[model samples]
Target: MGESVKYYVLLILRGMAMGAADVVPGVSGGTIAFITGIYEELLDSIRKIGPNTLKALLNEGIPGAWRQCNGAFLASIFGGIAISMVSFARMITWALENHPILVWSFFFGLVAASVVYIFRQLTSVSWREIMALAIGLGLAVFVSVARPVALPDYWWVVMLSGSVAICAMILPGISGSFILLLIGIYPVFIGAIESFNLPLIASFLLGCGVGLLAFSHVLSWLLKHYHNVTLALLTGFLMGSLNVIWPWKQILETTVDRHGEVIPLVQQNILPLTYESLIGLPSQLWPAIGVMFLGLFLVLGLEAISNNMSRCE
Candidate 1:
């Protein structure tokens, strides 16, 4: 009983980590799952809901297959994700609103440490891996710098964005929110959530539901046949995304909408760090850096516990 409760808590924590990553532009919930050793299991469990399970449900009824294949586990994990996303959305949104720079700084540190952790996990560093890493890095950088498109505020576009973004959501190197931002749907999608607009939200979710089923097949195949290569690529993807999430920057340009809200469309400059900035940092930056270190230590502690648990197993 105690062990079961402990695992449940761990899963909830994992879901929260996933939620945080999904909220960011360059990070991914899938990356969080991969680093935590739950990626393959998650893919497999989701894949079970295909034809075989459907047939079983129709023929033997829901209860039989549900019990035989452990539906409760899937329900528990996904339910946790759903709960975390909905519950944390407001709090995260508020944090981003009130403390954008500090929040980004903490995540910046998280990803920086994550890149190191992932690099250390690689068993071999061949020329192929090197090339792959460079390619991944370049691709991520390109995406980060590309100008956002002005997409139409149509329901169809919203659905398309949701489908594509959700597909990207599970890939560690790809940012789902960034995908939306690139497609010019980021503002509307975020607006829907912010305003509690039900129609737009429903359309987006329907598309995401469809995309998840389609994407899971590809993910499952990669896991089964090309696990190492996939992980390597994902690691490269995460490493490349560092450029997008880098914290220090200023809004060099700004515009206002009809509603009189200032929209900063382009960031004209990134404030590169100097020795003086670190040594004589302002109070806000210093506390943010400390929080960044705390985030790093949290991941390291989780890694240590995971290693110990693996040894016991």
Candidate 2:
């Protein structure tokens, strides 16, 4: 492949990784963007889509606006995300249902390794960074433990929820799907996607676009002005979010979805032995460990490959 094609292909692959991550409620695609070294560029590109882009479109036509907004890059990343999410959603959902421990264990490893990967990005050790990390961690933990609320049965509420979820999705530690779950709209959103609910999808996408445009500017500014502190906060977030992906959990509450199937809406993390005793299911400890290691190594390997690629470039 040519150089540009190769680069876009790399982006697509990265997007695929992000999409896969986003499929699981406890994982954030933004974490994948950070791992792949595209987080800032993604923000910059998204932030460029405003008045200037409009001016470019009017004066210089589609090409100018496309160039202004880094259309190719955005398209490649989002295309990959779309394709991967569609492909992996079913598999991940099935795994979560049939083998919850293994699925959560694998993601636990991924996130754990991710914590190290993110922490290494810090330039210096200081109190501000530490405090930020503490705050982020506390906030993430609070969100994880918070009770789920009923999604308001209104079009505007759906749109508003989408906006909030999209913002959470771009934060390295926060899971957008988890946000949906918190509002009791996860199943509704998922069903809409699966069944092709056009109006609902349109409203959600509109909210996403608006949220992206507004949030990117602030995030980009923060990264530029407060790089280390921001990263520290994100690292803290990643650390605190581990609770969401803990391998062994006892369901504290359940609810019936639109499909009339009972699903867990509230759960408490538990030990493997405790899980076996209380849930009366095999802990699957050894296998979970194996899968967890696979996830950890997979992240480290991706980082190594990305570093090598950067050096070669």
Candidate 3:
């Protein structure tokens, strides 16, 4: 592919990866983008739809905003995300249901690879940045470890759930679904999806849309002015997220909400582990290790191809 086309293609692939990550409860596509070094560009490009675009929309309408916002990039990346999520959602749901080990193995690989990719990008890390990374990682790990709970079922509760979940959706390392779970709304949102409850879904999407636009700009500004600090925090987030993706824990029973729908809860360390392990072999731990390596390698492989293409250009 030509250089421009190649770059756009990478963006789409990243979008797909993000879609896959977001499909799971703990992973964030934002984290994948951050690890792959496209997070800032992704945010900046999205943030291009600023005051001018709004003004134009007020005056000349959608077309003006379309032109001002570099609609092609948005169309491509978000389009990729939409396509991947819609197309793969069923398959992913099944895999998580039937073959949890193999599925999480792959994610383990993806995240491991992504961390390496991010680390490689950082030429030097100061203690301050390291501290930021640590903070991010710590927070992510905490989220991963928390127990899931029953959610509220009121309209106002739904609105609040939308706002909070949307924030996690935009931020790297956080899972929107998990955020819903934290707020005790996972079952509520899942019910909306299952029952095709349009009003409920619409309310949630409205919150997501508003949250996404607002958060994207704030993140864009942070990356613009405080690049290293932002990256550090994101790195911490990725590290912390490992707790959620660890593949062998057995789910305890489930809890039902006010609606009496059951949601699974988990307890940790159901499998054997040792310092020495191999790709999903000998035990579940090995597979998790292997998958983590695979994740890391995938990111590095893409980076290598990307860097070579830039050189050729």
Candidates, ranked, TM-score: 2, 1, 3
Each model's total of backbone clashes: 0, 0, 12
Error of 3 at 291 (Å): 3.8
Runs in model 1 deviating more than 4 A are 65-70, 253-260, 272-283, 309-313
Please tell me which model should have the higher lDDT, number 2 or number 3: 2
Summarize candidate 2's per-residue lDDT along 66-107 as a digit string, tens digits.
999999999999899888877887788788889888988998
**Better structure of 1 and 3 per lDDT:** 1
Deviation of model 1 at 22, angstroms: 0.9
Error of 1 at 194 (Å): 3.7
Give the alpha carbon lDDT tens digit for every residue of 215-253 in model 1: 988988985786656666777787777777766555555
- Rank by lDDT (best first): 2, 1, 3
Best by TM-score: 2
Candidate 2 lDDT (Cα, 0 to 1): 0.89
Native RMSD of candidate 1 (Å):
3.3
Number of the top lDDT candidate: 2
How high a TM-score does candidate 2 get? 0.97
lDDT of each: 0.73, 0.89, 0.72
